[model samples]
Target: MKAFQLVSPGKTELRDVDVPEPGPGQVLLKVTGSGVCHSDLHLLHAQQLPFPMTLGHEPAGQIVALGPQVNGWATGQHAICYIVWGCGVCRRCATGAENACERFPRGLVPGPGLGYPGAMAEYMLAPARSLVPLGDLDPVDSAPLADAGLTPYHAIDRSRELLTPTSTAVVIGVGGLGHLAVQILRAITESTVIAVDLDQEKLTAARGHGADHAVLSGPEAVPEILELTHGRGADVVLDFVGVTPTLSVGAGVVSSYGHLTVLGLGGGSVDFSASGPPQGLPWGATVSRPYGGTRRDLHEVLSLAQRGLIKVQVERHPLAAADDVLARLERGEVRGRAVLVP
Candidate 1:
């Protein structure tokens, strides 16, 4: 099988490698679609990941083989694969908190392309526990739901209690996760959604995904959000960018009892105030760092796609063009999510 192997930072190649067979409790999948996420670039360039890795996590494909002891699943079944491979007996995994499992470094999530060979090739292996049947949705579109969709789903679910019909929800940075956040908020809740980003293209996409208003982050962006909320500020602010400026914008526009969820891994910080006037807005703020979603969250996202409530916007690139896709993603040139067709 042909695979893109990240031999080291600043180096990757399309080389023929032996097809990986599923281990116990795992399954082998025929590669169909793998989304090129920003984290892949982080692993490629940031020196944060181990060397000689595969770099895709968001994957959707059909099962071709199953390991021993795996039941209730079979070959030829279309499935959207989960990247996390938790130890099923751990306290976190037992309580459905596999994302918090401590047995594996940086938690149990496979990191797909990071730790193990991911879906960038003709064949990949995954735990049968991570497979969710894709009954009616297109595999290309469902690929992003594996992470881009699931991350925001978990983030918003944490603050679902505050996102009431009368309250406001602000999504900062309408990129991969932010775009899906817009649609998820609209489809699942009645909160008035506001999207903030520096790119007009992404903002337009956000509006198309059901954001009631899209504001460009700048000198007047906060005032626009303030005006949209009738000066009370947003009730829930989700910062998918997690940059200093974006975090500042989110902090500037949240209401007193609002919740702020940060999903980006850009490595930035935000200062919070408990009393007195806030820095950007007139309210108290709390920051939440949500990892990837749980198994249940992944199931809900898949079900939502199966029901036609949400759509994944994708740009398909041939598997050989993986380097070019990564370049474009790093340069912020791709719109929506980019999926690799193997």
Candidate 2:
């Protein structure tokens, strides 16, 4: 098997490697499509990950081998691999909150492509529980649904209880996840959806996805959101970028008792002061950081995809082009998710 190995920051090479066999409760997948995400760029360039590993994680493929103790699945089954492989016995896992599982979290330790050989190769092994069957959808597009779609789904679903037809939902940073957030909000609720971004192209894509309004992020953004909401502010604001500016904007435009969900890992922070609302704003803002989705959430996303209710925009790249894909993603040149084909 040939794989792209990230030996260290600023370096990645394609090399022939031994194909891994599935252990107990695991399965080996013949790699079909793997999405190159922004996080992969961060991991590679920022050296946020340990060296000498494969990087692709958002994968969709067909099962070629199954390990002992795995049941209710078979070889040749097409599936989208769930990125978060959690310890099944954890309390969070037991309650379908595996995204928050405290024990044996997959992403925390790094495996395949990160800590282990990732899907950038011809073959990859994953826990059977991580595979979600994709019966009819194309694997290339479905690849992003694993994280780009699932992350926003979990983030938005957390605030679903607060969203209403009369409420306003603002998505900050209308990029990969932000664009999907707009569509998800449109499909699931009647809330007025506002898309915010520094890029006009992304904002236009947001409108195509279902945003009622797309506002450029700057001095005018707050006033624009306020005006759109008739001075009430947004009922739920999801900051997909999680940068200082976006978080500040989210906190600034939230209505009283509104919820703000931050989904980006940009490492930016915002402060909530006790001083009387600046500029006469009266809202109380809470920032909730959401990571990947739980198994159930992934299932829900797959169901939506199966029903053609959600669509993913992706640029396909060959496994050999992993480095170029990462370069483009790091420079923010990719408009949508980038899927690597083996």
Candidate 3:
């Protein structure tokens, strides 16, 4: 089987590798579609990584075989692999909060494409419990839902109470996950959704996806968001671009008692001071940096997709074009999610 492997820092190659067989409680999948993420770009440029590993995390495929002890799933079932492979015995996992599994980094770790072999290949192996049934959704287009959709859903679900009928929700950086955040908010919440982005096209797309207002990200972003909310500020601010500018705007515009969730891997930080109002979070405001979605989140997003409530805007490419797609993503040239069909 041919797989795209990241052999070293700042490099990747398509190499022939032996097909892997599923182990106990695992299933081998015929790779159908794997979504390339921005995190993959970070991994490629990072000095440290689980070297020589196949590089993809958002996977949707058909089951080709199931290993011993695997039950309740069939050989031809279509499924999307949940990215967080957690120890089921842990307290967090017991509540289906595997995204924050207590055992993680202490002998447990992130699933495929981050530390383990991923689905950017002809075939891939996944844990039985990590598989979520797709139920009539196209595996190719459904691939991004595993992350691009699920991540934002998890973030919004956590801050759901803040998004009341009269409340306001602001989404920053309407790119892959940000765009989905807008759609998910529109589908499930009555909050007025406002999208902010530096790109005019993405802002336009966000409005098309049900955003009530589109604000170009700049010095005016904060004032516009505040003005739109009638000077009370947004009750929920989701910053998918966690850079300095976006962080500043989020900090400036989020209302008191509001929830600010940062989902991007952009290494930007804001100063905090317990003493005052202009330095950090305002009185009663709360902030969180959320990881990927739980198993249930994946299921709910899939349900939404099945009902025709939300859909991923995708650009399809062959598995061989992984590097080229990565280049486009890095240059901010690709819009929406980019999926590699194997």
Candidate 4:
């Protein structure tokens, strides 16, 4: 099998490697497509992890082999690979919150892409529990639904109640996740959708996707949101880019009783002090950080994709072009999710 391996600082080289066999309780998938996520940029650029790291998690493929003790699934069955492989007996895993599994707190096992080999190669070894049946959807197109779509789905699912018809929902950062967030909000709720972004192209993409209003994210953004909401501010804010500026804008434009969900791993923080966005953290307004969607959330997202209620914009590249794709993503040149095909 061939894979793009991260060998040194901020570099990746395509090389041939031994195809991994499915161990007991595991399944081997012949990789069809894998999404190159923005989050992968941070890790691949740092190169702080061990050498020869395989760096893709969002994958959809067909099952080719199953190990001992694996049943109920057959070869040639298509499935979406669930990224967070959790310990089944843990409380979080029992409830489908694999991202919050207790094993991570105990240093028991790392996630598939973090420590184990990822899905960028021609073959992927996944736990039996990590495979979700990808019914009629194309594996190449459905790849982004695992992370780019699932992340926003989890955030919106957490803040669904606040997104009523009378409410104004603002999505900051109209990139991969932001684009999907716009579609999800449009399909599920009647809230007025406002998208904010630095790039005019992305903002235009947002409007075409479903945003009622697309505004440049800057000093003019909060005022426009306030005007759109008639000075009440937005009732729901999904900030996919969690930088200090975006967080300030997100917190500043949130209504007193609204919910602000920050899903980006930009390492930005919010202070509940006098100098923060709002004068005082008054009323029931809250800032919440969710890691990713639960297993059930991904299932629901995939179902939405299957029914064609939502569509993701992706640029497909050959698996050998992983390095070029990474550079494009790092330079912020890719418009939407980039899928790598084997």
Best by TM-score: 3
Alpha-carbon local distance difference test for all models: 0.85, 0.83, 0.91, 0.86
For candidate 4, give the lDDT of residue 69. 97
Over the full model, what C-alpha lDDT does candidate 4 score relative to the true structure? 0.86
TM-score of each candidate? 0.95, 0.94, 0.98, 0.95
> What is candidate 2's lDDT per residue for 1-342, written digit by digit as tens?
988878888788998889887899999999898888777766777556666777787888899999999998999999998787666687887876766777754446343455566788888999888788998999677888988889889988888888889999999988778778888899889999999999999999999988999999998999999999999899899987877888888878888888888888788887866677765335566667777878889899999888988888888888888888788887889887888998
lDDT of 2: 0.83
Instruction: TM-score for candidate 2, please give it.
Output: 0.94
Q: Candidates 1 and 2: which is better by TM-score?
A: 1
lDDT tens readout by residue for model 3, 1-342: 999999999889999999998999999999899999999998898677778999889999999999999999999999999998888889889887788888775543578898889989989999999999999999898998988999999999999888899999999999999989999999999999999999999999999999999999999999988999999999999999899889989999999999888988788986667877766788998888888988999999999999989999999999999999999999999899999998
Ranking by lDDT: 3, 4, 1, 2
- Total clashes, candidate 3? 0
- Cα deviation at 64, candidate 2, in Å, is 0.6
Model 4 misplaced stretches (Cα beyond 4 Å):
47-50, 106-109, 274-282
Residue 80 in candidate 4 has what lDDT?
91
lDDT of 4 at 340: 94
TM-score of 3: 0.98
Q: Which stretches of candidate 3 lie over 4 Å from their true place?
A: 105-108
lDDT of 2 at 136: 96
Best by lDDT: 3
